[model samples]
Target: MTEKLFSPYQFKSLQLQNRVVMAPMCQYSVTAKDGIPNDWHQVHYVSRAVGGTGLIIIEMTDVEPDGRITDQDLGIWSDDHIPAFAKLVDGMHAHGSKVAIQIAHAGRKAQDASQPVAPSVVTFPGEAYKEPRALTTEEVVAMVHKFAAGVRRAVQAGVDAIELHGAHGYLIHQFHSPLMNHREDVYGQELSRFGVDVIHAVKKEMPADMPLIMRISAIEYADGGYDIDHTLQVARAYQEAGVDIFHISSGGEGPSGQRKPGNYPGYQVPFARRFREELHVPVIAVGMLEDAALAQAVIGNEDADLVAIGRGMLRDPYWANHAALELGVSKEHAAIAEQYSRGY
Candidate 1:
């Protein structure tokens, strides 16, 4: 039998309903500014869960104020936001989906309508960027605290797993990228130190049984920025720090990587496949994957342990259910949250 997309895969302890992970795509429809979760969040996520995604990873939520990409990002730093997210998570679980929260600090990529905030005050050749105040060492320490508190809230909200958003030039990733982090201090000089401190704090606060995954941009796609060499090194250390999975993505290539290399099916799988061998960790591959054949091929070839679908699901919310039917996925797997009598 061909391994189905919704097959249950055991990751140490937690069981994911399927390999069809809903990649964290920003919806930008939060409570706005306050970083609170509201009805919008509840509906947006539940829709995907209801649509038959195996794992419904929530949007890129902020761990702090300056982390907001726009005024519409969801936040978990405060306990007040838990009830709404709890409802969302509960509803998703009720609909038969494992949930993962993709949490991050936006760092210098913080933006308003037109202005972008960045680590150093390097003007982007006339792109109205915010003159970000370099975060003090004390402030950095506080940010770590915020991440721990956010995880606690995620646990309260009842998410099945946690995906630390360390990719795409966000706060944690910005520090990891040489182009963005220009500080001469430890954070700036030591490109890999920031993520370590974060995982250290997060691990301390998390329950031993909960699965923690790192969502990372394995390549910066830019020449002067983060590259495969640096990212692989970071992954080695991160696995040692105890993450259960590595969610791989690309871009933030600065300028050189901006060539619109038209999206091809599994365009980014090579990175994940390489990381799987180098890091020896479960890797989640996300890119232009849309077909069941291609996804099966990736998993079958051991290119990646799992495949993450973004636009494909958006194109078809019931992508997993239908794909499961076509690929003949098991209906009795533990990862199957709750199966609908009829396909979406």
Candidate 2:
């Protein structure tokens, strides 16, 4: 029988050696604060490629400097930043791993910014968070262009795909969240408007065949947060706006209230299934899917088209290779690097 976890998976222009995905996790190692990826970023990602991840989604790369959670996060706001990203993309490709970048804006979550921006003046729930200034109607339109510009750079850098960070309480999420967006403009009237606009703008910059991925919170955990039903409506709008794949995750809009995020393995898998069944689009499941058997079941059970391992990959860079071996996959099928074959 073919082991679904280790089986090849493809969608649009993205073809992966296996179903394992290295979920985008912020390294916050950009010491230069100039938004350019440096040596730390290169070694960090390329090592994962060497470890055998099929798809390595580069960390939450912000579209603008102030859009970063901290000054240390990666950014693609300028033409000057393209080469650094291109080099990283090349290294990952050389290891036979496909690459994707999660373009985002941290919005009110930009803790280091002197003044952060969001759809409205509400502050993210934290003592460290500042009350963000609201973007004027004209500035909101300009922000869409900024997103397109960032995606254009990613394409030039040669990423196999692009994933927009519409999840978490970032700029996109802020615009879409009823808790965060108290605007009186058209953006306020339609929660998905900002995300749809950004999606359309970025799609224009991408190749017609290249798939566009959007990471979205399927449910919010904060008090008064929207439920899955609400997100389904929002996601439907996104799908129509040209999102080819959905990376299903939940929460990050604010602190958990009555409905806390689950703490068990495959907790988020059901959400992924819901997205797949309802929207009829491929979805990637993330959250605590580290165990080899469990990850395999997520695929074998047809819960998600792909599984993203965030902390597991961080703990063991060779998680994919190890999982393949544990699942009884042959070395040839596992594609373990020749240099590491003896060790396996």
lDDT winner? 2
**Angstrom error at residue 223, model 1:** 3.7
Model 2 residue runs over 4 Å out of place are 30-32
Q: Write the per-residue lDDT of candidate 2 for residues 171-239, one digit (tens) a residue.
A: 998899999999999999999999999999999999998999999999999889999999999999999
lDDT of 2 at 6: 83
Candidate 2 is scored at a TM of: 0.98
TM-scores, each model vs. reference: 0.90, 0.98
- Pairs clashing in candidate 1? 17-335, 96-337, 96-338, 108-117, 221-253, 222-253
C-alpha lDDT of all candidate models, in order: 0.76, 0.93
Ten contiguous residues with the weakest lDDT in model 2: 27-36
